[model samples]
Structures are given as structure tokens and as C-alpha cells.
Target: MSQDLQYWKQLKEKNDASAIKYFYDQYIKLLYKYGYHFCQDATLVEDCVQDLFLRLWEKRSSLGDTDNVKLYLMVSLKRSIYEKLKKNSKTTVTEEVPEDTFDVTFTMEEQIISSETDQITKDKLLECLETLSGRQKEVIYLRFYNGFTPEEVSEIMQISNQSVRNVQASALKKMRNNMDDPLLILVVGKLIESFFHEI
Candidate 1:
């Protein structure tokens, strides 16, 4: 196992407060940002995150080792968001979770774009991003931005590995329509292209 993964596993097994706090500190922002994609309420995200950590701490000793700490936490956060939303949704009959509710913003400050012309391109990219389903965007964020492998993404997304590949294929097909837009490629990075090629 990787040293870093082993370190976290040891920390969790020992119930180290610093390690627990470090996990919370390191991931809170990403978790909050990602959770907001599902539910717009900031306080709800904050509460769920806090509750997630609390439950983790409460069950730390019993938890199994994880090679990818971030992905494990991310999967937990996604579940927390969905469960909270479902409970608060208060439907008498089961209702489908809205598939298009995710929102992700790519800002110019990220330095992938630098010119006024690129600003227009950034706008176009965001417009194109909206063409994707929420799960598509989630997979893109996980696979491209965060560098998770397809198997890892399958675990975090709670889908079969085949399903992850299928979602990636579909998302890329939509993105292929904009392959001529160099600015879009630059902004999201050639990671998209590389990911597609590898798949």
C-alpha cells in the first residue's frame, strides 16, 4: 500500500484527533462545493459534512482500510447529500432524484484562460458544460479534475465499472461535438482527450 494511505489507515485505527481533523480540514471545501451541486443550501451542506465527520469518528476503529481516502470521503459525502435531500423531500411516494440538478463553475482565476477572447470561450464552455447531465458532470469532475481512475470512480459513484465507462463514453461523445473549440479544450484540459483515448 502507498505510505500515505497506510498513514491515514493507521491514524483512523488509532482514532487520532489530528488525523481526523486533517481529513475534515482538507476535504471540507471540496465536499461543500460538490454537495452544493445536489442541494443549493449552504447550511445543509455544512451540517451534513459535520455529521459525516462525526459519524466517521464514531466508527473509526471499525472502518476498513482504504487506499483512496479522498474518494472514500467523497462517496460518503455524496450519500449524505442524497439521504438528507431525500428525507427533507418528504414525498409520500418515492420520487426520482433530479438528475440535472448539479451545478459546477469553472472560474477564469484558475488560469486555464487568460484573455478577453478566452473569457468569451469560457462562457461558451460553461454553456456546453450545462449540456451534460449531472452525473456526467460528476464523472468529469472526478475523472478529469481529480484524476480518479475508472475503477475508483465506480466505487465513489456507487456504479458498476462498466457503468462508469459507459457514462464517460457518453459524456465524451457530447464533448466531442465541441472538439473544434480549442479554448474549451485548453480550459478543461487535454485530460479529457487523454481520458477518452485511454478508455
Candidate 2:
């Protein structure tokens, strides 16, 4: 077993505070980023993340084993955020969160994009990204940015495996058709390399 899995098992079986803290220390930043995508409220996102860990610790005795702790955490966090949103909506003071809130805004580091392309190409890439639907953007983010497999994304998004593949395919095709330059396509593929930075 990998070290992460071992730590997770320790956390589950022995209620190891150090093991749980190790996970929190490693993933809190990424979790915050992912949670922020679901709800732009930074404070709300932070609360949900803390609540997730607290609930995990309380329920650790009955938790199942997992080979992919990061994926599991992300799936749990997404659900937690949505549940919180739903609860908030039921209250008197209403807040509107659009169904398609998986917005993707690109922030290219000078070293990453400038060395290869000028401003025009960068602009074209951003335009191409804008063409994708929120679902498509979410699929792309989960697939490339987070390096999740299609099956994994299906689990995270609560969609069918084929739907994940279809959305990903259509999103890529849309971007390819929108952009004339091949370099833009290359950049899109390299989105895993901090192209989708923490919000």
C-alpha cells in the first residue's frame, strides 16, 4: 500500500490524529480551491472544508478503506458544499448560486505562455475556453487539472462514465474548432501544470 493509503487506514482504524493532520496539511489548499469553484464565498468554503474534516474525524471508525484519498476527499467536499448550498437556499435570506458555476478562468504565468505565444494567441485560448459550458469546464478541470481519470471524474461529478467521456470529448472538440493555432491546444493540454491555479 502507498503511504497515503497507510495513513488513511491508520486514521480510520486507530483514530490517528497525526495521520489525519497529515492529510489536512497536504490537501487543505487544494480542497479550498476546489470548494471555491463550487461556491465563490471564501468564508463559506473554508467553513465547509473544516466541517468536512471534523465530520471525517467523528465518523472515522465506520469509514471504508480507499486507494485514492484525494479523490475521496474531493467527492466528499463537493457533496458537502452542495448540501450546504441547498440548506442555505431553504433559509429566509436567499442566495443564488447558478447551476453552471464551474467557471474556468485562465491565469498564464509569463514563463509558461509568454515563451511560446504572443498576446493574440493567449486571447484566442481564453475565448475558446469561454465557449465551454459549465459542465464541460468542470469535467475538464477534474480530468486535466486534477489528473483524475474519466471513471474517477464520473464519481466526482455523479455522472455516468460515458457522460464524462462525452463531455470531455465535446469540450476539447469545441476548443479545437474555436482556435486556429496548434499552440493553444498544447496549452490546454498542459492545464495540469498550474494553469488552473488556486482561486
Candidate 3:
């Protein structure tokens, strides 16, 4: 197994309050960022993160050997968000409905340097994300932004597992088509890794 998988397995085996605290401290920001992307409300995002950690701690003993704990967190967050949305019918925006405009705090220049991607590539990818259908964007966010598995995403989105795979594949294809710079793509990948690790 990869080093990350090994670490996660160890964490799972321990399943103590300290272990849960460690997980929360490490991943809370990433989870909040993901939740904010979906809900665009800081309070809601914070609540989701809190609820997810609470749920994880409560069910830690029953948790299986997940190759990726980050993925599990993402799945949990997505499910929580879906439930939140479902509970309020007026908040249920169709996949195609345009989300309200919100500030993207990461400036292009900052992202280029911090993410190690060229300004052009960074801009292109951001633009590409905007171009994607709402469902496609959600899948991309869940997959890369929060690291959920397709099965997890399928459950959250109430879609078939195959549909989740298809959306992810489509999103990747679109991103690849838009971003022709290999170096830039590698840098972006590294940035994503850094974001998760540093959080």
C-alpha cells in the first residue's frame, strides 16, 4: 500500500479521541473549503465540518479500512450537504442552475505562484471549471477538492456509481482539453497535494 494508505490504516486502527482530533485538525480546513464551495455560506460550511467530525468520531469503531480517509471525509461532507439541501426545498437548486456569484479569494497571480502553475494555465483551469455543467463541477470539486471516491459521490448525489464515473471522466477530459501545459498540470497537482497536506 502507499504511504498515505498505511497512515490512514494506522489511524483507523487506533480509533481514539486523540486520533479523531488529529484527523479533524488536519482536515477541517479542506472540508470547510469544500463545504463553502457548495453552500457559499461560512456558517453552513462550519456546521457541516463540525457535524462530519462528530459523526466520524461516533462511528469510528464501525469504520472499515478506507484506503483514503480524506475520501471518506469528502463523502461524509457531501452527504451532509445533500441532506441539508433536501431539508429545505427552496434551497434545492437544480444541477444546471447557476450558483450565486461568490468571491474566489485566490487571485490568479497568487495561485500561479503559490500553486506553481503559470498564470495562463491557472486562468484556463479556473475558466474551464466555470464552463463545466453544475453537476460536472460538483463531481470535480468532490473528487479533487475533497477527494471523494466515485461510489461515495454517487451515494451523495443520488446517482448510479457508473454516473459518477462518467461525470468524473467527462470533467477530467474537459480539463485536459483546456489545459495543454503538462508542467502547469503537474504544478496544479502538486498544489492540491500541498493544500491537503498543509491543512
Candidate 4:
């Protein structure tokens, strides 16, 4: 293990609150960024990040050996988002929003065009996600959006670790095969490309 991993392990072993806080401070922004990509709502992403860190801290005693803390955070965020989505689906939106409480702004033609393009790209990605089998979609979401190791995912999903890896590999292959729409593929490709660049 690298020095950082060794440091984290020692801190983890000690169950130090400062170490946990340090970990959260270090990775929260990255987690929020990834969460925003999955949720597309700033407030929702903020809530998810806070909840994820809270859970991580609470479960720190039982946390497994993780060489990559960032990956662990990512996986936690992914699972949280999925749970949020599922819960929201089952809940009724009965809360009323006052018209005056909302701000409506007019956009310039260029801004409007850009907004439309972004929506189009997001729609295409959602469509691609929908094309996946339920299990495949779950695995892909956990792997890419959450950054979970296959073993972690398997433990959570109650499947074999190899099965998690297989599902992820198969999902990516199928997504690539189904990328017949050049524009959509280009958009998705750019998004994935940007992720690597940021890393």
C-alpha cells in the first residue's frame, strides 16, 4: 500500500474523528461533482454527499479494507442516489411550491440553444441507461457513478464478486455495441472522456 493508504488504515484503526473529518473534507467536493452528474440537481447532490459522509463515519468501524478511499466514497454516493431515486418514485409529490418562491429567468438565444443541447445529451444518456437490463443498469451505475469495487458491489447486491465484474463488463460492451446514434455516442463518449481527464 502507498503512504496515503497506510495513513488511512492507521486512522481507521484508531477510529479517529479527526481522520474521518479529514477524509470527508478531502473528498466531499469530488463526491458532490459525481453526485451532480448522476442527480442533475445541486440541492439533491448536496444532500446525498452529506448523507454519504455521515454514513461512512457512522459505519467506519465496520468498513472493509479499501486501498482507494475515493472509490469507496464514490460507491457510497452511487448507492445513496439509487436509494433516493427509488424512494422518490414511491412517494407522492404533494408539497406545493408557491409561484413567487420560484425564479423564472428569460434566456438569450445562445443560452437557450446550449441548454437544449445539454438536455439532449442528458436524455440520450438516460435512454442508454434504460436500454440496460435492470441488473446490468444497477451494476453499471454502481461501477461508474458510485466507483465501487466489484467485490463491494457484490456484497451489497448479494451476488458473487465475479458476477458483479461480469455484469459491468457486459453492460459496457452492450452499451458500446448499441451506440448506433453518432450524436448520442459522441456526447456519452465526451462525458466519459472528461471524467478521465479530470482524474
User: RMSD of each candidate?
Assistant: 3.7, 5.3, 7.4, 10.5
lDDT of each: 0.75, 0.78, 0.64, 0.62
- Tens digits of per-residue lDDT, candidate 2, 4-118, equal 8989989988889998799899899999999887888888899999998998899999998788999999999988888788777764435544557777675555543555666
* TM-score: model 4 vs. ground truth: 0.47
Off by over 4 Å in 4: 1-3, 91-199
| Model 1 accuracy (lDDT, Cα) | 0.75
Error of 2 at 145 (Å): 1.2
For each candidate in turn, the TM-score is: 0.79, 0.81, 0.58, 0.47
- What overall lDDT, based on C-alpha atoms, would model 2 receive against the true structure? 0.78
Tens-place lDDT digits, model 4, residues 20-138: 67777788777776566456667877888888767766776787887776666766776677667656665545642221111111122331123456766655555566667756755
* Residue pairs in candidate 2 whose N, alpha carbon or C atoms collide under 3 angstroms: none
- Full-model lDDT, candidate 3: 0.64
Sort order, TM-score high to low: 2, 1, 3, 4
On lDDT, the leading prediction is 2
Question: Model 3: per-residue lDDT, tens digit, 58-131?
Answer: 77667677766776677688667766765655654554323332223333444233555556766766776676
